[model samples]
Every structure is written in structure tokens, then in C-alpha cells.
Target: MSINVFLFSKSFAQQHTFEVKNGSFVYDGKPIQIHSGEMHYSRVPHEYWRQRLKMIKAMGMNTVTTYVFWNFQETAPGVWNFSGDRDIAKFIKTAQDVGLFVILRPGPYVCAEWEFGGYPWWLQKVPGMHVRTLNQPFLDSCKTYIQHLAAQIKNLQITHGGPIIMVQAENEFGSYVAQRKDIPLEQHKKYALAIKNELVHNGFDVPFFTADATYLFKGGSVEGALPCGNGEDNVDTLKKRVNEFHNGEGPYMVSEFYPGWLDHWGEKFVKVGAKGVVNQTEKYLKNGVSFSYYMIFGGTNFGFTSGANDGDSPIQPDLTSYDYDAPISEAGWATPKFDSLRSLMKKYVTYQIPDVPDAVLVIAINEIKLNKTVDLFNGIVKNIQPVVSDTPKTFEDLNQGFGYVLYRKKFDNAINGTLDLKGLRDYALVYVNGKKVGELNRQVKKFTINIDIPANATLDILVENMGRINYGPNIEKNLKGIISPVMINGKIITGNWNMYKLPFDQVPDLSKQKSSYVAGNPVIYQGAFKLKKVGDTFLDMSNWGKGIVFINGHNLGRYWKVGPQQTLYLPGCWLKKGKNTIQIFEQQNDVKNETISSVTKPVLDKLNLPKE
Candidate 1:
């Protein structure tokens, strides 16, 4: 096997040094300028890294900036994955290979519209864990991650012949204030210094900088480095801000010039006009200011990595499609944004931009009706034990993220009365004696129903974690499963509730069923669809309530009954020519009556199709 080291070396790092002289960026002790753009390698596949870098280079960009999501690296604490698309080192090397210098932002908390601000879920398990603060536990973990990451790329630094020139200390820290305008200067400085010190101690010699909104700087202080903002809409404003901040001593820089925006679950897709981006880029270049577009290419949120945001409105969780209306689409196809930027970039840079790569070929397969079915409740009861509770427990107390939990309790009192669920986060489907009783949805925050029950009968209440709060200021407060207390007839139920965590990662063992097929808890529904050929088709999830869907074992991600996403786009890569097995683990045991359908277009469309 051959190993290449020159791919990591940067031209500026080989012999050139960047300095600030007379308020101007001096490279190799001479006035220097830069044109940069931002993109994430994890968002794009490994095969497309070089092409995207070349695209940026073609856009006349001399520098390519990227954020190293800690969650993507150390998925679990102390566990690191650098292979495949998570290869940050390889990404940097590829950038250098394309004649582009690199800027690295390794954030333990990068709010790049990522889940948990790039912090891994396991971090929340730590005792008394507080993120992005002076918390010792948080700081200790941050230090460990920084040390490990620095070791990987520190040697590749410009001072060490590596492509990385500048390292950002943190990402937009002032956006969370009460007014969305004040920076926690003291806390920000302390944390930045802590990270800077840790990196320096770990042998990272590159200059450090911070990226925030322009007005945020007034609340904080940047002692010995560059401070760039995000609101560089036009060249004149960008120049004025840079001149005011740097006192005309250095080139103006927009750390995050928004090129496009992201979409929430219920919102329509967003697209930023190409003319505006081109005009802005031209203005910045002509004014001699360096800029980095927030996201040149947006990729898939694959798996459970998607996050939600909270503002003044309800929480908005991001959809699986991370097509942020970027230059590069979610499927890695370049749109008009890409070509417009490419043409604009060629005017200033000397590097040759490569042609866009071809899109993945799509193959279509015929749809077939699947009639094979497995009875879910055909089993003998071994131990039908039930506890007593006046009221049920909410999802919060269960400590689960998303999914269903069954609460069974024996009630001896004869009641032909109404049953009231105090805190059903969103929705619930009631069942009595293996029969459908009634349904409730929390959208209106009401889960009341009338049912006649025999005296001392076992009453079972199953609750679903109808999609956790995906966005808004309430995001951090999102807890899966049942959230609050359950009440019956204005009385709270208090008893020992059997809690089941239904996260996809904890696949329950199916071998314990006494019958050839066990139907209820942790049931895996399988159906085979015969297709003459396989091609790209959208799986219409409108029939299915809420559950993760898998095709032939490949996880397509979590699907919800809530719109405006009723269909999931299935790429042909995971499909087979003959028989394809569709498996669903429904949270509601009684939802066996619901049938999922596959359609060619988005299920939410007004086109009426034949229903099976």
C-alpha cells in the first residue's frame, strides 16, 4: 500500500507566513488577499470531495473552509471514525490536492443546523452535564476531543507544510442571547482561551479566529486575532465594517455569508437567488474582502443526525432532506447556483475548475401488491401481570427520545366512564381487548375518550413519541417518549410503570416469543415487493403512522405520518431487481390495520391515485 504525504501540504504553509501589517493581510510578509467558501465533507460523499473543492477553486476561491463536527468524529466518546465520509484528514488532503488552502473549525459545539449543535448524544449522559459553558465535565471532554483532533492534523498545519492556515475557536456564540444580539463576552473569551490554550499545548501553531454576527463583537473582545461577522450582504457594507473593526489594518472577512437557507418539517423548500449570491461575491472580491459562503453544498442529514431549532415559535425539526438550497443539492448535483458561482470565481483565481460530475443513474422498478401478512397478537399469555395506577406517566419521566411505551395497570373499579389522558405530547391510539377503542392527538392537547371497562380489568395505555420538538428555543428541552404526568378523571395515576425504550438502536430480541410469530412489543413487520427492475421511487409513508423504514436492511430513516413529507425518496442503490423486503417497526401494536403504499410522487401532492 502506498501512502501520500504531499497531499496534506499547503503552498502557503511550505514557506509563506501570514501577518497583519498596516491593517492589511500580509502573506509571506506581503499584502495578501483570500477568497474562501464553506462546505462540509460529511454532507457530501467522499467521491465528490475533490469535485466540490475543484468547484470552489473554479469559483475563484483560494481557500476552502470546513467544520469538523465532533459528533461525526467521536460518535461515542473516545471512539473515533476517520474512514469513509468522516475522513477529515483525507478531506483536507483533497483540498490541497485541488490547489486550495484550508481553514479548519473543530467545534465541540457547531450549530451548523446539526443535531445537538454537533455534540454527541452520549455527552448528555454525563452527570450534571452542561454544554458550552464553564462546566468542568464539558470542558474536560472538549479538551480531550481537541487534543485528539489536533494530533491528527497539527502536523499538516501550514507551519508544518499542511494545508490548514487558520483555525476558528468557536462558531456563532452570541446567537442564543435574549435579544439575539448580545454576546456573552466574558464566557466566550474564557472558553475561546481554554480551547486556544489546549490546542497550543497540543502543538497547534496556526493563528486562531472566531466567527459571529457583526454586532456581537461589541459584547466580546478578540485579543490577538481576526474577528469576522456574517452580515456581509454587499461590498460597501462589508468594507465599511472591516475598516471600522480592523481600523483599515486587514482584509475584511465574512466568516459565514449565507448563500441559502434550511427547511423545517412543515415548511416548503427554500432557494436563494443565484443573482444575489453572484452580485455579493463580485462585490466582496472587488472590495478586496475575503468571504466564506456558509454552505456551498448541503448533504443528507442521514440517520438520526438531524436536529431541531427553537425561536419564538414552536420547535421545528429539520427534515431528512438537507437540501439547503445550496449550490450542490442533497444528491450531490450542481444547480444553477454552482455554475453562476463558478463563472464569477474564474475571473479572479488562476486555478482551473473541473466540470461537474455526472449524477447517479436512476433505475425504476415496477410496484407489486404485497398480501402476505403475519398475525401480531396470536400468542398465549404466559404472565399477564398488571399494576395499579390512578393516572398514567408522561413521556418525560420515561427518559426516552422517540417511540412508544406501553403502560399496563389493573383496575378493579367498574367504570363505564370517560378516560382522560392528561399529557399526551402529541397523539395516541387507544385499544381495548385487542380491539381499537379510540384515538387522541395532542395537536389540540386533548386525549379524552369514553370506553366501557369490566371491573378490575387490565387497562393498557400505549403512548407514541410523535416526533420530538425539532426546532425553536425549546429544542434543548425536548425529551422523547412520555413527557409529563397522566391524569384520569382529574386524578393523577401513581404506580410502578413498566418503561420500554424504543429507540432504533436498541433492537429488541425477537427469539423470546412462544409462538412462531410474536405480534406485539418490538414486532418486525416484513412484506416482500416484487419488482421487474429497480429504480428511484418514493415510498409513500402516508399509510404508516410513525416508524423507521428499512429496505432490504438499509435504513431509510424515520418516517412520520405528519406532513408535508408523506413520501420518502428511496435511491436505487439499496434496491434489488427481484424481491425487496420492506420492514417496519410500528410503535402502535394496534396499527396493523394501516397499510403503507409506495408512490412515484410526493404523497402530499394533490394528485389522487388508486388506493389499494
Candidate 2:
């Protein structure tokens, strides 16, 4: 019996061994090429996690890549959640169950176009905090996070018979350093090394790597870690770039090979054709290179978690749908691209790939009438108490992260002129005496508007925190709402102002609220429909103006009439078989019909691109 136990232990110890050696990835003493696809467990419904993994594996991918979002895990300082959708270990184990390896990218700074680049919003509130830096405060917070995260995933490493063979240290840090001229390169390198060290200290025993573009290697690459490239299409350039930095070594890999592009509000939808993607992927496979599709199955951003980008523009917030036009649709259905890629992968893979999972059930519900309507000021605003402040406070100042903030002030005297919202972060709706007169959008660089006021008129400005900038130097100061005071006719409109905190963390109860819809004012429209059956469906919002949709208390995400994205992808897992309730917060009350319909397919490319 003792001899048998010794043999079993030896076999287990020799089961898995993955390492980067001699310019190639050596797995179990043999060279192997890794075909991986990126998918974030946070973006997809937890109920559909297994299905997504199965679909990716069916696409002939032997490995699955995912980013561990710090902000999603640690909601507040010293507070962490690792259950349900935030469960990284379960996600890894599920990948193993589907016969795929795991490559973990646990970014204290994962700029997957995620909110605040996945840094907890409260991180900005930390005293003397300089994010992505070796600043003690930020590093201390990072250490605590790594410690807690290790407790959840440390034992799941490949060294311990887990599927996680490779772990990423910091995500695309060089790109950030290159954009920020204020910080020194050496300092950034030290900061990157510090994070990698913290991961090592916390029991991450797998091979570590740093990913960046070719030019960013100087700033992003750390000693004792392999340097990989991102977005480099040409296999030659990819190999040359890695060899240049790695003492002429050859196990070249592209950590983020984009199959499709990201979408932002007010812009046309970004699409990548199957021919080009197939061509590039063929080159990678033929050349015996390792690569991972940035998103093989792009999922939904769901709720206020969508982020924005500021690439020499004011601010372009990402849409609710992170579909990325990938091979897999947002509703977990396989697309034509998936078939083409799977066919291409079959030629290279030795083992037989499993057939794609059967498509989930999809049902279309006809228009459901909105039976209840309540104005923003008359009803919804009254639900929360306002913070009395002599000066205007930004969202961060009030300790609020996401959603809207209502700024109110009463004037005893009459006034009329151009009102400028100094420091309007993203978007705002201006109202005079419960009437929405005009709006201010940060995306188009519109911050001032002409307004007429009457004596004793109460003014309210509803500012929506569209999203925090996910990339570049601008990420540091992404303070939403009005950061400064209001100005009318070049004069400061100052006094005791009331700032209402509407984080919308919890959906408000409108069951008892009476209907009071005022045209042109933000209204909460509620309705219920009997659903004897429920499945994946899309809520059509093309006829409605900009606002958010909440179904059965789940915040589906924001919608706008601007264009590109007109429907919110509602997962079937969130719906019930009986009655389902949907509440919409329409900003301009521009709905041609006060009702919505659920369709079988998503309407992502319907473009009403804003006329600047």
C-alpha cells in the first residue's frame, strides 16, 4: 500500500510542467503552440460562464485567457467578494473542466476598456495616492489586494495541478507610461516590478510575463519576466520585436490579437471582417506562433461598469454592449465568424474539436405598455436626501462612484443668459422649474447653453457620470459631475446648493409612486408583462431617448438614441418564467411610443450618429 501511494504521488508530480525555455514554450518536455481567447468572467452572466467556456473550446482553442478585474472584486477598501461572478478560482476550474488551459491576467491595472482601468473608484480617495506607481499608499493597497486574491487562487496554479500555467504581472503598463510624460521611465519599471514581486510573494508560482506593444518594452518589461507583445499582426515583426528585447529568444506570443474593435457612444459600430481575421489567424497558426484573440466571445458590459476612452478627444464612453463583433454574439450564440475560425483551427489542431454547444432558447415578446410614469424631480429625486453644500461637489467628493448627481439651487431674483457648467465631466441635463430646457455633453465639447430664468425659479442640473476614462494620463483625474461652480451671463451663480446622491446602487421602488410624466423631463417608466417562458432576448430602445433600463431589478445598462447601440442585451438567466418588470429612466422623454419590445436578435449597428 505504501509503495502504491508513492507511485501515485510521483505520477501526479509529473503530470504537468509548463515553462518558457530556449525561445519556445515547452510543455511536458515538448514544444507546443498555445491558441487562446480572452474572456472576462465579470462581463458575462455567471450562469452562462460554463456555456461560454464550452463555446470557446469548441472553436478549437486549447487555452482560455481572462483578466481578473480588481475593481470588480474589491468594492471598497478592505472589502472583497470572491463568490458568484467574481469567483476566479471557479472560473479557472470551469475552464479545466472544458478541457482548456488557463492564462490568468490578474491586473491591479487591467485596461480592458474597463471603468477606472479596473482600479477601485475609492482608490482616488486614498491620501497621497498615485495609481500605477510605486507610491507607498497605492502599493500598500495593491499588496492587500494581492494577498486576498492569492488566498482565493494561489493553490490553483499549474505547479499545483491547476490549469493556470502562465500569470501576467501588469497589463500594458508601458503604453500608459509612454503616454504620461510626467513620470520617469525608471520609476514606472520599479512600480511594475513591485507589483510582480507582490504577486510572487503571495504564492503565484507560475511563469510570469509582461505584455505591451513593441515600442513599449523599454518601459513595460521587468527583469526575470518574459516580455510579450500586443496588437502586432505581422508574425515577423512580432517575432523580431520579442527577440530584440529577450536576448534573441524565440517563443513569441501576442497577448492581445484583436479580432474586432471596441465601440464608443455616438460613433459608428466597429467591425472586423472574417476574411482579414481568418487571414491573420492563419498566419499565426502556420508560423507556429502563440496568440490569444483579444475577445473570442465578447460579452455585455451590463450596468454602469462600461468605461470610456480619451484619445486626444474630450471623452468617448463605451456602449453597454461589449460585443466587439466577435465570433460569438453577446447572447452566447455562435456567429459566422466562429465557424470560419473553427474551420481554420481544425487544420492545425491534432485533437478533434467538440461541436459548438446548442444555441440557447430565444423568445421575442411583443411591445409591453409602460403603465406607470414618474418625473425625475416630482418623484425619483424626492426619494434621496440631498447633501447641503455652499459649493458644488463632484461625484468623488461626495464618495459616490457611478450614476447621476442632481445639483439644485434656488434664485430669489430673475436672470437669463448663457449658463456654463464649469468642470462638467461628461454629460448633463439642465432644467428650469421642472422643465428640461437644454443639455450639455462633454463628448461634443458642449459645456455652455443659453437659458432663460424667472424670479424664485428653482434650477436643477442632472449630471450623468457616463464612465471614467479607461486609458492614458487622463485616467488619474476622472472626476465626474460638476467639479466647479455654475456661471450665468459670465457671472458666478453661487449659494447654498443641494446635491442629491443618486448612485443608483439599488433600484428605487416605484410601485406606490403615481404617474406624473412631464414632457421633456426625465421620467421613470415602469411596466410588467407575463412571460410564461423566458430566454435570451434584446430590449429594443431605438424609439426611446437616452436612459438606463432595469428589468426585475437587474440594471441592463444605458441606452441612447444617438446611434450604433439601440438595444440592451438582457440575459435569460435574469428573467423569471412568470411576471417580469422593466423600468426605464428616459432622459428626454423622446419615446415615440411609451413601450418596449423584446426581440430575438440584437440591434447594435443601427446608426443615428450624432450630428456635431
Candidate with maximal TM-score: 2
Error of 2 at 212 (Å): 0.9
Deviation in Å, model 2, residue 165 alpha carbon: 0.9
Candidate 1 segments whose C-alpha is farther than 4 A from its true place: 1-33, 44-60, 177-185, 234-236, 240-248, 368-478, 506-524, 527-545, 566-582, 586-612
lDDT of 2 by residue, 496-519 (tens): 899998887777688778779778
Residues 38-157 of candidate 1 have per-residue lDDT tens digits of: 888876657667766766665556778988888788866578988888888999888878777788888666777777667765666678866666578988998888887877788767
Q: What is the TM-score of each candidate against the true structure?
A: 0.79, 0.96
Error of 1 at 126 (Å): 3.0
- For candidate 1, what is the TM-score? 0.79
**582 in model 2: Cα distance from truth in Å?**
1.2
lDDT, model 1: 0.63
